[model samples]
Target: MFRILNNSDTFITIGREYVLEKYDKKREEWLHIPLKANIGFQADGMIIDSGSETSFFASFDTFNYNFPKGDYRIIKVLSSEGDGILLYDDFKIDK
Candidate 1:
C-alpha cells in the first residue's frame, strides 16, 4: 500500500502505470521485475486536487515466488496537463 500526496498548486493526474524494480549491485542498475500479473484490475488514471491525497493498494502473491532479500522500489508517473513527473519510493525486504 502507498499514499500519493498532491502538494502542488494545480490538480494532478496519476495513472496506473507503475513498475517494480530491484537493485543489482553488480550491474549498478535497477532491474524491472514483473509482478503485476498477480494484481487485479486497475483504472487508467485519477485526478487529485491540490492539497488532496490518495492511496493505492498493491497486492502481490508472495507465496508463489522466492524473491531475493534486497532493496526494491516502486516507480510511479504523475502528470498535470500533460506534464509528467517521475516519483519513486525505495524499500527493503528481509527474510
Candidate 2:
C-alpha cells in the first residue's frame, strides 16, 4: 500500500505508471526489471486536490519470475510519457 499526498496549492495529476528496479550491491546501482507482461494500463488522469491525499494498493507477484532476494523499489511515475514527478520507496525480499 502507498499513500499519495497533495500538499501543493493546485490540483495534481497522477497515473498508474511505475517501474520496478533492483539494487546491485556489486555495481552500486539500480537496474530496471522489465515486466514479463503489461500488468495494467495507465490512467488518463487521477486528480488529488490540494492538501488532500489518496491511498492505493499495489502488489508485485514474483511467483512466475525468478527474482532473486535483495533490495528493491518501485519508481512511481506521476505523469504521462515518462516525464514528470517520480516517487519511490525501498523494500527488501528476505525469502
Candidate 3:
C-alpha cells in the first residue's frame, strides 16, 4: 500500500518484509519499504515518482469499486494528447 505523507512527494512505503530501494537516485545506499508477498496484483513496469503530488494506477483492464459519494470539485489538466495529469492548490509537503 502507498500513502501520501506530504503535499508534494508521495512516500512509497513497502508492506511487511525486507524490500529495499535506493535512498538517492545517484547513490548506492539502499532503503527498505516492507514487503507484502501477497500483493494480489503485479506492476509490470511500475513507475513511482516522488516529483508527482498524486497517486495513480493505470492500464488496468477493470476495477471493482464503487464511485466516491461525496462533495468533489472539477479538476483540470493540461497535457499532450497522450498524457493526463492532475492539478490542486494549497501545496505543502508534510510527513
Using TM-score as the measure, the top candidate is 1
TM-score of 2: 0.77
Please write out the lDDT profile of model 2 over residues 14-87, one tens digit for every residue.
87666778899999999887665745645676877889988766656622356689998877766433447788
Sort all candidates by TM-score, best to worst: 1, 2, 3
Q: Provide the lowest-lDDT 10-residue window in model 2.
A: 57-66
Residue 49 shift from truth in candidate 1, angstroms: 0.6
lDDT of 3 by residue, 6-69 (tens): 2334433221111222233355443333334544434232233445433443211232322232
Ranking by lDDT: 1, 2, 3
Steric clash pairs (candidate 3): 14-33, 15-34, 16-35, 17-35
List the RMSD of every prediction in angstroms.
2.6, 3.3, 15.8
Clashing pairs in 2: none
Model 1 quality (TM-score) = 0.83
Structural RMSD, model 3? 15.8
Question: lDDT for each of the candidates?
Answer: 0.81, 0.75, 0.30
Best by lDDT: 1
In model 2, the runs with Cα more than 4 Å from the true position are: 38-40, 62-64, 79-83
Give the Å error, residue 46, model 3. Answer: 11
